[model samples]
Target: MEKQTPTLESSSQPQLKLAYLRPGDMIDVEFASATKVRTKLQLVGFDTGRYLLLKQPNPRTEGSYADVLFEGNPVIVRLVLEGEAGECIAFKTKIRAVTNFPFRLLYLDYPEQVENRALRAQKRVRTHIPVDVTADNNQADNTKKLASGVIVDISSAGCRILFKAQNEGGNVTHMNIKVSIGSGSQKDLLMLSGQVMNQKKERGMISVGVRFTDEEAHIIEVFDHLLIDTEFEC
Candidate 1:
Protein backbone atom coordinates (compact mmCIF):
# COMPACT_ATOMS: atom_id res chain seq x y z
CA MET A 1 0.00 0.00 0.00
CA GLU A 2 1.18 3.53 0.89
CA LYS A 3 3.75 2.58 3.48
CA GLN A 4 6.15 1.31 0.84
CA THR A 5 6.21 3.96 -1.92
CA PRO A 6 8.25 7.14 -1.86
CA THR A 7 6.47 10.45 -1.61
CA LEU A 8 7.23 12.98 -4.29
CA GLU A 9 7.98 16.60 -3.60
CA SER A 10 5.83 19.12 -5.35
CA SER A 11 8.63 21.65 -5.42
CA SER A 12 11.99 20.30 -6.54
CA GLN A 13 13.13 16.68 -6.33
CA PRO A 14 16.78 15.88 -6.53
CA GLN A 15 18.26 13.05 -8.53
CA LEU A 16 19.20 10.27 -6.13
CA LYS A 17 20.82 7.03 -7.07
CA LEU A 18 22.11 4.22 -4.88
CA ALA A 19 24.19 1.67 -6.76
CA TYR A 20 24.84 -0.28 -3.56
CA LEU A 21 21.37 -1.33 -2.51
CA ARG A 22 20.79 -5.07 -2.59
CA PRO A 23 17.89 -7.35 -1.95
CA GLY A 24 17.06 -8.14 1.66
CA ASP A 25 18.48 -4.87 2.93
CA MET A 26 16.18 -3.26 5.47
CA ILE A 27 14.77 0.20 4.77
CA ASP A 28 12.44 2.56 6.52
CA VAL A 29 9.98 4.35 4.24
CA GLU A 30 8.69 7.81 4.97
CA PHE A 31 5.98 9.86 3.34
CA ALA A 32 7.03 13.23 2.00
CA SER A 33 4.76 15.43 4.06
CA ALA A 34 4.70 17.63 7.07
CA THR A 35 3.95 14.71 9.35
CA LYS A 36 6.22 12.35 7.36
CA VAL A 37 4.48 9.13 8.22
CA ARG A 38 6.99 6.33 8.57
CA THR A 39 6.80 2.58 8.05
CA LYS A 40 9.19 -0.32 7.67
CA LEU A 41 9.75 -2.34 4.52
CA GLN A 42 12.30 -4.69 2.98
CA LEU A 43 13.80 -4.86 -0.48
CA VAL A 44 12.54 -7.93 -2.23
CA GLY A 45 14.36 -7.70 -5.54
CA PHE A 46 15.08 -5.44 -8.47
CA ASP A 47 13.98 -5.41 -12.09
CA THR A 48 17.50 -5.82 -13.42
CA GLY A 49 18.46 -2.31 -14.59
CA ARG A 50 14.93 -1.08 -14.42
CA TYR A 51 13.59 -0.62 -10.92
CA LEU A 52 13.61 -2.02 -7.42
CA LEU A 53 10.83 -4.35 -6.38
CA LEU A 54 9.97 -3.88 -2.77
CA LYS A 55 7.85 -6.14 -0.64
CA GLN A 56 4.32 -4.77 -0.60
CA PRO A 57 3.89 -2.27 2.20
CA ASN A 58 1.28 -1.87 4.90
CA PRO A 59 0.11 1.70 4.51
CA ARG A 60 -1.47 3.85 7.14
CA THR A 61 -5.10 4.53 6.40
CA GLU A 62 -4.84 8.23 7.11
CA GLY A 63 -2.12 9.38 4.75
CA SER A 64 -2.24 10.83 1.23
CA TYR A 65 -0.67 7.69 -0.16
CA ALA A 66 -3.68 6.90 -2.30
CA ASP A 67 -3.67 10.28 -4.00
CA VAL A 68 0.05 10.30 -4.51
CA LEU A 69 1.30 6.75 -5.09
CA PHE A 70 -1.39 5.53 -7.44
CA GLU A 71 -0.72 3.96 -10.80
CA GLY A 72 1.24 6.24 -13.20
CA ASN A 73 1.82 8.66 -10.38
CA PRO A 74 5.39 9.84 -9.94
CA VAL A 75 5.60 9.71 -6.15
CA ILE A 76 8.62 10.37 -4.08
CA VAL A 77 9.55 8.42 -0.97
CA ARG A 78 12.30 8.95 1.53
CA LEU A 79 14.15 5.71 2.23
CA VAL A 80 16.40 5.24 5.21
CA LEU A 81 19.22 2.70 4.95
CA GLU A 82 21.89 1.76 7.44
CA GLY A 83 25.39 1.18 6.21
CA GLU A 84 27.40 -1.88 7.18
CA ALA A 85 29.33 0.31 9.58
CA GLY A 86 25.99 1.40 11.10
CA GLU A 87 25.73 4.80 9.41
CA CYS A 88 22.30 5.84 8.23
CA ILE A 89 21.67 7.16 4.74
CA ALA A 90 18.52 8.57 3.28
CA PHE A 91 17.53 8.30 -0.38
CA LYS A 92 14.73 9.90 -2.31
CA THR A 93 13.06 7.73 -4.95
CA LYS A 94 10.32 7.91 -7.52
CA ILE A 95 7.93 5.04 -7.95
CA ARG A 96 7.52 3.90 -11.55
CA ALA A 97 5.00 1.15 -11.32
CA VAL A 98 3.11 -1.10 -8.94
CA THR A 99 3.09 -4.73 -9.90
CA ASN A 100 1.24 -7.81 -8.71
CA PHE A 101 2.26 -10.48 -11.19
CA PRO A 102 5.43 -12.41 -10.19
CA PHE A 103 5.10 -11.13 -6.61
CA ARG A 104 3.56 -8.26 -4.72
CA LEU A 105 5.90 -5.29 -4.92
CA LEU A 106 6.25 -1.61 -5.62
CA TYR A 107 8.78 -0.79 -8.30
CA LEU A 108 11.10 2.09 -7.53
CA ASP A 109 12.89 3.28 -10.62
CA TYR A 110 15.52 5.98 -10.07
CA PRO A 111 16.44 7.77 -6.90
CA GLU A 112 18.46 10.72 -5.66
CA GLN A 113 20.54 9.48 -2.80
CA VAL A 114 21.84 11.88 -0.19
CA GLU A 115 23.31 11.75 3.24
CA ASN A 116 23.80 14.03 6.23
CA ARG A 117 26.82 12.81 8.13
CA ALA A 118 25.85 15.16 10.90
CA LEU A 119 23.05 12.78 11.77
CA ARG A 120 25.66 10.82 13.67
CA ALA A 121 26.11 13.36 16.42
CA GLN A 122 29.17 11.80 18.00
CA LYS A 123 32.24 9.77 17.23
CA ARG A 124 31.54 6.07 17.75
CA VAL A 125 34.03 3.66 19.22
CA ARG A 126 33.24 0.04 18.60
CA THR A 127 33.86 -2.21 21.59
CA HIS A 128 33.16 -5.66 22.90
CA ILE A 129 32.52 -5.83 26.63
CA PRO A 130 29.95 -7.73 28.62
CA VAL A 131 27.87 -5.05 30.32
CA ASP A 132 25.53 -5.91 33.15
CA VAL A 133 22.57 -3.58 33.12
CA THR A 134 19.60 -3.33 35.43
CA ALA A 135 16.73 -0.90 35.50
CA ASP A 136 13.70 -0.52 37.73
CA ASN A 137 10.34 -0.06 36.05
CA ASN A 138 7.86 2.29 37.60
CA GLN A 139 5.04 0.42 35.89
CA ALA A 140 6.16 -2.85 37.41
CA ASP A 141 5.88 -1.65 41.01
CA ASN A 142 9.41 -0.20 40.87
CA THR A 143 10.77 -3.69 40.35
CA LYS A 144 13.52 -4.29 37.83
CA LYS A 145 15.48 -7.20 36.42
CA LEU A 146 19.16 -7.46 35.58
CA ALA A 147 20.07 -8.08 31.98
CA SER A 148 23.40 -9.15 30.62
CA GLY A 149 24.47 -7.75 27.30
CA VAL A 150 27.48 -6.78 25.23
CA ILE A 151 28.17 -3.17 24.43
CA VAL A 152 28.56 -3.16 20.71
CA ASP A 153 29.42 0.47 20.12
CA ILE A 154 29.53 3.54 22.27
CA SER A 155 29.73 7.30 22.00
CA SER A 156 29.59 10.22 24.34
CA ALA A 157 25.89 10.49 23.75
CA GLY A 158 24.78 6.87 23.97
CA CYS A 159 25.64 3.21 23.40
CA ARG A 160 24.13 0.35 21.49
CA ILE A 161 23.86 -3.05 23.09
CA LEU A 162 22.57 -6.47 22.19
CA PHE A 163 20.72 -8.19 24.99
CA LYS A 164 18.49 -11.17 25.57
CA ALA A 165 15.69 -10.79 28.06
CA GLN A 166 12.22 -12.06 28.68
CA ASN A 167 9.60 -9.36 28.50
CA GLU A 168 6.43 -9.55 30.50
CA GLY A 169 3.76 -8.63 27.99
CA GLY A 170 6.19 -6.28 26.31
CA ASN A 171 6.84 -4.38 29.50
CA VAL A 172 10.41 -3.62 28.46
CA THR A 173 9.93 0.02 27.61
CA HIS A 174 11.37 2.34 30.30
CA MET A 175 13.89 1.87 33.09
CA ASN A 176 16.55 3.55 35.19
CA ILE A 177 19.74 1.92 33.92
CA LYS A 178 22.78 0.94 35.90
CA VAL A 179 25.31 0.14 33.21
CA SER A 180 28.29 -1.88 34.40
CA ILE A 181 31.04 -0.72 32.11
CA GLY A 182 33.79 -3.27 32.62
CA SER A 183 34.30 -6.66 34.11
CA GLY A 184 35.90 -8.10 37.24
CA SER A 185 37.69 -5.64 39.53
CA GLN A 186 38.03 -3.13 36.71
CA LYS A 187 34.29 -2.86 36.42
CA ASP A 188 32.77 0.59 36.86
CA LEU A 189 29.02 0.86 36.78
CA LEU A 190 27.25 4.11 35.86
CA MET A 191 23.86 4.82 37.26
CA LEU A 192 21.74 6.57 34.65
CA SER A 193 18.09 6.75 33.85
CA GLY A 194 17.33 5.98 30.22
CA GLN A 195 14.56 5.08 27.86
CA VAL A 196 14.69 2.76 24.89
CA MET A 197 15.22 4.89 21.81
CA ASN A 198 14.94 2.06 19.34
CA GLN A 199 14.98 -1.74 19.44
CA LYS A 200 14.97 -4.68 17.12
CA LYS A 201 13.96 -8.15 18.25
CA GLU A 202 15.48 -11.38 17.08
CA ARG A 203 14.32 -14.61 18.62
CA GLY A 204 14.57 -13.81 22.33
CA MET A 205 17.16 -11.10 21.93
CA ILE A 206 16.65 -7.36 21.73
CA SER A 207 19.19 -4.97 20.30
CA VAL A 208 18.57 -1.77 22.20
CA GLY A 209 19.52 1.73 21.18
CA VAL A 210 19.89 3.68 24.39
CA ARG A 211 20.21 7.44 24.78
CA PHE A 212 21.72 8.20 28.15
CA THR A 213 19.97 10.71 30.36
CA ASP A 214 22.95 10.69 32.68
CA GLU A 215 25.42 13.44 33.28
CA GLU A 216 27.67 14.24 30.35
CA ALA A 217 30.81 13.80 32.43
CA HIS A 218 29.88 10.26 33.40
CA ILE A 219 29.12 9.10 29.87
CA ILE A 220 32.21 10.83 28.56
CA GLU A 221 34.33 9.00 31.10
CA VAL A 222 33.07 5.65 29.86
CA PHE A 223 33.51 6.65 26.25
CA ASP A 224 37.06 7.72 26.93
CA HIS A 225 37.86 4.41 28.55
CA LEU A 226 36.36 2.51 25.63
CA LEU A 227 38.33 4.57 23.11
CA ILE A 228 41.62 4.06 24.92
CA ASP A 229 41.01 0.36 25.49
CA THR A 230 39.92 -0.27 21.92
CA GLU A 231 42.98 1.52 20.56
CA PHE A 232 45.31 -0.44 22.82
CA GLU A 233 43.66 -3.75 21.86
CA CYS A 234 43.99 -2.91 18.21
Candidate 2:
Protein backbone atom coordinates (compact mmCIF):
# COMPACT_ATOMS: atom_id res chain seq x y z
CA MET A 1 0.00 0.00 0.00
CA GLU A 2 1.16 3.55 -0.71
CA LYS A 3 2.08 5.55 2.44
CA GLN A 4 1.34 9.23 2.98
CA THR A 5 2.64 11.80 5.48
CA PRO A 6 0.43 14.16 7.44
CA THR A 7 0.89 17.88 6.73
CA LEU A 8 1.43 19.55 10.12
CA GLU A 9 1.76 23.32 10.50
CA SER A 10 3.40 25.05 13.46
CA SER A 11 0.08 26.00 15.05
CA SER A 12 -1.78 22.84 13.95
CA GLN A 13 -0.89 19.27 15.08
CA PRO A 14 -1.96 15.99 13.50
CA GLN A 15 -5.18 14.64 15.07
CA LEU A 16 -5.02 10.90 15.77
CA LYS A 17 -7.68 8.54 17.12
CA LEU A 18 -8.24 4.80 17.08
CA ALA A 19 -11.16 4.34 14.71
CA TYR A 20 -13.00 1.02 14.33
CA LEU A 21 -11.08 -0.90 17.01
CA ARG A 22 -12.08 -4.01 18.95
CA PRO A 23 -10.27 -5.93 21.67
CA GLY A 24 -9.27 -8.84 19.43
CA ASP A 25 -9.34 -6.95 16.16
CA MET A 26 -6.14 -5.99 14.33
CA ILE A 27 -5.72 -2.43 13.03
CA ASP A 28 -3.30 -0.61 10.73
CA VAL A 29 -2.49 3.11 10.74
CA GLU A 30 -0.59 5.28 8.22
CA PHE A 31 0.94 8.75 7.95
CA ALA A 32 -0.16 11.27 5.33
CA SER A 33 3.31 11.38 3.66
CA ALA A 34 3.15 7.84 2.23
CA THR A 35 6.26 6.99 4.29
CA LYS A 36 4.68 3.82 5.72
CA VAL A 37 5.32 4.44 9.42
CA ARG A 38 6.04 1.22 11.31
CA THR A 39 5.65 0.87 15.07
CA LYS A 40 4.30 -1.49 17.73
CA LEU A 41 1.12 0.11 19.14
CA GLN A 42 0.00 -1.54 22.35
CA LEU A 43 -3.37 -1.46 24.17
CA VAL A 44 -1.16 -1.42 27.24
CA GLY A 45 -2.21 0.83 30.17
CA PHE A 46 -5.72 2.23 30.38
CA ASP A 47 -7.17 4.76 32.77
CA THR A 48 -10.80 5.96 32.78
CA GLY A 49 -9.60 6.89 29.28
CA ARG A 50 -7.64 4.71 26.88
CA TYR A 51 -4.00 5.74 26.53
CA LEU A 52 -1.42 4.33 24.11
CA LEU A 53 2.33 4.66 23.70
CA LEU A 54 3.76 4.40 20.21
CA LYS A 55 7.12 2.63 20.57
CA GLN A 56 8.87 4.58 17.82
CA PRO A 57 11.49 2.84 15.74
CA ASN A 58 15.09 3.61 16.66
CA PRO A 59 16.64 6.52 14.62
CA ARG A 60 13.13 8.08 14.45
CA THR A 61 11.37 9.86 11.56
CA GLU A 62 13.54 12.87 10.79
CA GLY A 63 12.97 16.39 9.53
CA SER A 64 10.18 18.98 10.20
CA TYR A 65 7.55 16.36 10.69
CA ALA A 66 4.87 16.38 13.43
CA ASP A 67 6.49 17.69 16.67
CA VAL A 68 5.55 14.08 17.19
CA LEU A 69 9.25 13.45 17.83
CA PHE A 70 10.43 14.63 21.23
CA GLU A 71 13.57 13.62 23.13
CA GLY A 72 14.32 11.20 20.26
CA ASN A 73 10.84 9.64 20.67
CA PRO A 74 7.41 9.90 19.04
CA VAL A 75 4.70 11.64 21.02
CA ILE A 76 2.54 9.28 23.11
CA VAL A 77 -1.13 9.23 22.11
CA ARG A 78 -4.15 9.25 24.41
CA LEU A 79 -7.13 7.83 22.49
CA VAL A 80 -10.80 7.55 23.43
CA LEU A 81 -13.35 5.89 21.13
CA GLU A 82 -16.62 4.01 21.49
CA GLY A 83 -16.93 0.24 21.08
CA GLU A 84 -20.34 0.50 19.45
CA ALA A 85 -20.72 -0.58 15.79
CA GLY A 86 -17.29 -2.18 15.94
CA GLU A 87 -15.53 1.12 15.26
CA CYS A 88 -13.29 3.61 17.09
CA ILE A 89 -12.92 6.82 15.07
CA ALA A 90 -9.86 9.04 15.72
CA PHE A 91 -8.76 12.48 14.54
CA LYS A 92 -5.98 14.93 15.38
CA THR A 93 -5.40 18.70 15.52
CA LYS A 94 -2.61 20.81 17.18
CA ILE A 95 -2.99 19.09 20.56
CA ARG A 96 -3.42 15.47 19.36
CA ALA A 97 -6.52 13.79 20.79
CA VAL A 98 -8.85 10.96 19.72
CA THR A 99 -12.43 11.78 18.77
CA ASN A 100 -15.72 9.98 17.91
CA PHE A 101 -16.46 8.25 21.28
CA PRO A 102 -14.88 6.61 24.30
CA PHE A 103 -13.08 3.26 23.63
CA ARG A 104 -13.87 0.05 25.47
CA LEU A 105 -12.47 -3.47 25.31
CA LEU A 106 -14.59 -6.07 23.48
CA TYR A 107 -15.02 -9.77 24.07
CA LEU A 108 -16.56 -12.13 21.54
CA ASP A 109 -20.19 -12.83 22.43
CA TYR A 110 -20.63 -16.22 20.78
CA PRO A 111 -18.60 -19.36 20.38
CA GLU A 112 -15.97 -18.96 17.67
CA GLN A 113 -16.55 -22.48 16.39
CA VAL A 114 -20.21 -21.76 15.76
CA GLU A 115 -19.33 -18.58 13.96
CA ASN A 116 -16.67 -20.32 11.84
CA ARG A 117 -18.85 -23.28 10.89
CA ALA A 118 -21.47 -20.88 9.57
CA LEU A 119 -19.08 -18.57 7.70
CA ARG A 120 -16.49 -20.88 6.13
CA ALA A 121 -16.91 -24.07 4.16
CA GLN A 122 -13.85 -25.59 5.86
CA LYS A 123 -15.43 -25.11 9.32
CA ARG A 124 -12.25 -24.16 11.11
CA VAL A 125 -11.98 -21.79 14.09
CA ARG A 126 -8.69 -19.92 14.42
CA THR A 127 -8.60 -17.34 17.19
CA HIS A 128 -5.70 -16.27 19.42
CA ILE A 129 -5.74 -16.16 23.23
CA PRO A 130 -3.45 -14.45 25.73
CA VAL A 131 -1.92 -16.87 28.27
CA ASP A 132 0.99 -17.42 30.64
CA VAL A 133 2.80 -20.57 29.36
CA THR A 134 5.57 -22.86 30.62
CA ALA A 135 6.91 -26.40 30.03
CA ASP A 136 8.62 -29.19 32.03
CA ASN A 137 10.76 -32.19 30.90
CA ASN A 138 11.04 -34.25 34.03
CA GLN A 139 8.00 -36.47 33.57
CA ALA A 140 9.55 -39.61 35.13
CA ASP A 141 10.51 -37.70 38.29
CA ASN A 142 8.26 -37.87 41.34
CA THR A 143 7.57 -34.13 41.34
CA LYS A 144 4.27 -33.06 39.71
CA LYS A 145 4.89 -29.73 38.04
CA LEU A 146 2.32 -27.59 36.23
CA ALA A 147 2.39 -24.96 33.51
CA SER A 148 -0.12 -22.10 33.61
CA GLY A 149 -2.03 -20.61 30.63
CA VAL A 150 -5.36 -18.91 30.07
CA ILE A 151 -7.86 -20.52 27.79
CA VAL A 152 -8.02 -18.14 24.84
CA ASP A 153 -10.93 -19.86 23.13
CA ILE A 154 -12.47 -23.31 23.05
CA SER A 155 -14.13 -25.48 20.45
CA SER A 156 -15.54 -28.99 20.55
CA ALA A 157 -12.11 -30.36 19.67
CA GLY A 158 -9.28 -27.97 20.52
CA CYS A 159 -8.13 -24.68 22.04
CA ARG A 160 -5.32 -22.09 21.81
CA ILE A 161 -3.31 -20.52 24.67
CA LEU A 162 -0.36 -18.15 25.18
CA PHE A 163 2.50 -19.15 27.46
CA LYS A 164 6.17 -18.57 28.22
CA ALA A 165 8.83 -20.85 26.83
CA GLN A 166 9.63 -23.61 29.39
CA ASN A 167 12.80 -24.86 27.81
CA GLU A 168 15.50 -23.54 25.52
CA GLY A 169 15.49 -26.62 23.25
CA GLY A 170 11.91 -25.93 22.01
CA ASN A 171 11.09 -29.65 21.94
CA VAL A 172 7.85 -29.53 24.01
CA THR A 173 5.27 -32.15 23.10
CA HIS A 174 3.15 -33.04 26.14
CA MET A 175 1.88 -30.84 28.96
CA ASN A 176 -0.38 -30.84 32.02
CA ILE A 177 -2.54 -27.96 33.17
CA LYS A 178 -4.55 -26.93 36.21
CA VAL A 179 -7.18 -24.52 34.88
CA SER A 180 -9.17 -22.32 37.30
CA ILE A 181 -12.52 -21.12 36.03
CA GLY A 182 -15.14 -18.68 37.40
CA SER A 183 -14.51 -16.86 40.69
CA GLY A 184 -15.10 -17.39 44.41
CA SER A 185 -17.99 -19.72 45.17
CA GLN A 186 -18.56 -20.87 41.60
CA LYS A 187 -14.89 -21.19 40.67
CA ASP A 188 -13.75 -24.55 39.44
CA LEU A 189 -10.29 -25.89 38.75
CA LEU A 190 -9.45 -29.01 36.79
CA MET A 191 -6.36 -30.85 35.69
CA LEU A 192 -5.86 -32.09 32.15
CA SER A 193 -3.21 -33.08 29.62
CA GLY A 194 -2.87 -32.14 26.01
CA GLN A 195 -0.51 -32.36 23.05
CA VAL A 196 1.01 -29.23 21.56
CA MET A 197 0.01 -28.83 17.94
CA ASN A 198 1.64 -25.60 16.79
CA GLN A 199 3.66 -22.57 17.90
CA LYS A 200 3.99 -19.07 16.51
CA LYS A 201 5.45 -15.64 17.42
CA GLU A 202 3.26 -12.57 18.04
CA ARG A 203 4.38 -9.16 19.24
CA GLY A 204 7.65 -10.65 20.62
CA MET A 205 5.74 -13.43 22.46
CA ILE A 206 5.54 -17.17 21.83
CA SER A 207 2.05 -18.73 21.57
CA VAL A 208 1.29 -22.42 21.67
CA GLY A 209 -1.93 -24.01 20.34
CA VAL A 210 -2.92 -27.35 21.81
CA ARG A 211 -5.30 -30.24 21.16
CA PHE A 212 -6.64 -32.03 24.22
CA THR A 213 -5.65 -35.66 24.72
CA ASP A 214 -8.20 -38.47 24.55
CA GLU A 215 -8.19 -39.00 28.31
CA GLU A 216 -9.19 -35.38 29.03
CA ALA A 217 -12.91 -35.64 28.22
CA HIS A 218 -13.96 -34.09 31.53
CA ILE A 219 -11.93 -30.97 30.90
CA ILE A 220 -13.57 -30.60 27.51
CA GLU A 221 -17.03 -30.86 29.09
CA VAL A 222 -16.26 -28.02 31.50
CA PHE A 223 -15.12 -25.90 28.59
CA ASP A 224 -18.44 -26.58 26.90
CA HIS A 225 -20.32 -25.14 29.87
CA LEU A 226 -18.13 -22.06 30.07
CA LEU A 227 -18.53 -21.37 26.37
CA ILE A 228 -22.28 -21.93 26.28
CA ASP A 229 -23.58 -20.77 29.63
CA THR A 230 -21.60 -17.56 29.88
CA GLU A 231 -23.39 -14.48 28.52
CA PHE A 232 -20.84 -11.93 27.30
CA GLU A 233 -22.29 -8.43 27.17
CA CYS A 234 -19.78 -6.74 24.91
- Model 1 lDDT tens row, 1-234: 233445333433333335556566566765443344566668776654567667666555443355444455444444433321344445565667776567657777645445433245455567787777777454546645567888787665666778875664254555456666663444545444566666666567776777788787765565565553322211
User: Which tens-of-lDDT digit does each residue in 72-163 have in candidate 2?
Assistant: 22221222332111122333212123322244221111111100011111122333432333343435354333445556555444556655
The number of the candidate with the highest lDDT is 1
Q: Which candidate is the best by TM-score?
A: 1
Instruction: Give candidate 1 regions above 4 Å deviation.
Output: 1-50, 55-64, 79-86, 99-104, 110-116, 138-141, 164-176, 186-192, 202-205, 221-234
Ten residues in a row with the worst lDDT in model 1? 225-234
- How high is the CA lDDT of each candidate model? 0.58, 0.37
What's the true lDDT of residue 105 in model 1? 74
